[model samples]
Target: MTTETPVKTSNWNVPNALTTLRIVMVPFFGYALLHDGGDSIGWRITAYVLFALAMVTDKIDGDLARKHNLVTDFGKIADPIADKAITGMAFIGLSIVGSQSGEAWYVAGGEIWWWVTILVLVREWSVTLLRLSIMKDVVIPAAQLGKIKTTAQGVALGLLSLPLVADDNAWGDTGRVIFYVSQVILAVAVGLTLWSGYEFFRDAFRQKRAARA
Candidate 1:
């Protein structure tokens, strides 16, 4: 009698590969921005271009994973980590550049008076810690509002990386104004993110109680 080898069941297939690729792009994106040499149009354009490519990969990875039923433990965990890495790093990086270069900071329509970048970074880590605490028991599903909040954040981050100075001649003051608008949008997104985290905890606790009963 011949024995056959057993195959392991895994979500780590083609779709997951793509998701992993997207995660890998986060560091490359950061490097692109950090290495950009100047306030020149070409350099800024290159930075923005790389950022856009990374963002596109982010969307593609998720879509492919869901479409192909390739969602994995790795994908689920790593996807969010990639998102936080890219967005958080970009925001902090841009803020440092802005502060060092003396650029105005705005989120949506509001001005960020304090160290807004630091606040966002802290918030992301805090929320991640809370979610990890929940995950030790059961996986918390993403809320609809949380999805919207994330979309807003991606848009805001993309806009933040825009080379506003490149258009200073014609757009002049308009570019500065648009930058502030993007900032306000980000601030609002953060608020929504916090609210969704509260909901996640509330539901998780309820589930735990029900399980005990």
Candidate 2:
């Protein structure tokens, strides 16, 4: 009887391509989001489309990689980076839009708070950095809470990316409704964001402590 060895899959695959495409889309998405200082209604709509594309591609690539056994080192690294890049751009760009719009921007009490952006980004990046730093020594696998956080964030940010108010500060009834809904969703996301961060740090610290013991 002869023993067969497992074959190593090549990195050139659909999932990796999608991940790379997502990374490439980040800047273009940001550009569209911030076009005309976030006042270009057309560009804001364009940005929303681009953002939706990124989110869909992200889901597709991850599914493809898992289903086809095409998971590679590159995918692992680039996938999270792509996710972070797109969302980070959304947060920052939306904040800029909110700051520029002033009182008129407060449609139905909807505005992207700079403090919220900073807090969420800090928690998100800190987790990513710590995960990468201790990946070899202590693997802290992602929790389900993280997925919920991501989904909530995606929905909220996508809504906020739209030009919810006119340049002249006239907010339509529908626009106001949507803006208020998005803000409510964002508040939920922020809560989840903090809770998930706490879970991640708790798990990471426990793992590290166990390893040292």
Judged by TM-score, which candidate is best? 2
lDDT per model, in order?
A: 0.67, 0.85
Which sections of candidate 1 miss by over 4 Å?
1-12, 36-38, 106-114, 166-174
Task: Give per-model TM-scores.
Answer: 0.78, 0.91
Which residue pairs collide in model 2, if any? none
What is the alpha-carbon lDDT of model 1 when measured against the actual structure?
A: 0.67
Candidate 2, 92-174: lDDT as tens digits: 88888778767544641334889999999999899888888887788776789889989999999998888776555555777
Residue 202 Cα positional deviation in candidate 1, in Å, after optimal superposition:
2.7
Evaluate model 1: give its TM-score: 0.78
lDDT of 1 by residue, 8-71 (tens): 3386577567666766766666665555332444544565676677677778887887786667
